[model samples]
Target: MSVPILKQGDVLIASIQSALTDRDLLQLKDELAEKVGRLRSRGVVIDVTALDVMDSFATRTIRSIAAATRLRGAETVVVGIQPEVAIALVELGLTLDGIATALDLEEGLDVLVEVMEARRRDR
Candidate 1:
């Protein structure tokens, strides 16, 4: 199933409501990248609260999504990673290296706001 991406102010919120296949993950990455540019969004928040499993492919795809959107001039924040998933990713040696993360959607948006504000100040 296709992920629903919503435009909230200058941010695009892509909430993953279920466990997605590799194809769905790739589609989401592409869709978010395209929308970030088309919508001229300053930030992207990906909520993965409902995702119980985040395998290597999913982790890599999410990292690529962040990198792609960043190149398009939008900051990306991933939120709602469960404790078990976090431990699993760490044990598997998969890291979300350069991507920003938050505990929930509210914190995710807050992080985006802070990052956007910092960028503005830098400019």
Candidate 2:
């Protein structure tokens, strides 16, 4: 139950294998903060497709993770949401609306790289 971090064309990609709950949220928060800090660029991708269920704790933890990343001046893109989870979230009217999501890792990376490239151009 840990998050694995990798680098791809200046983007930081992270995959979490643990169920998100209060008991594990603290560890996740700590590790994610550290990993985001270590990233070489401001673009990051968080893949949670393996997550079986998303409760309030899970939702809030992901929000926290996104916030933490943003605070470090990094942008987070979530990818690979299970179809059932998507339907559940919609049915429940859950608001993960503020966070950016992509269809898959490839799409997520494309979005990240596009945004990063835009930022580079602006700089």
**For candidate 2, what is the TM-score?**
0.81
Model 1 TM-score relative to the real fold:
0.96
Candidate 2 lDDT, 1-123, residue by residue in tens:
556678776567877676655766667667767766775558788888887677777777778887887787667788988898888877877768668889888999888777667756876
lDDT of 1 by residue, 9-36 (tens): 9999999999898999999998998999
Error (Å) of candidate 1 at residue 57 is 0.5
Give the CA lDDT, 0 to 100, for residue 40 in model 1: 97
Best by lDDT: 1
Clashing pairs in 2: none
Residue ranges of candidate 1 with Cα displaced over 4 Å: none
Q: C-alpha displacement of 14 in model 2, angstroms?
A: 1.7
Worst 10 residues of 2 by lDDT: 17-26
TM-score of each: 0.96, 0.81
Candidate 1 residue 33 Cα shift, in angstroms, is 0.9
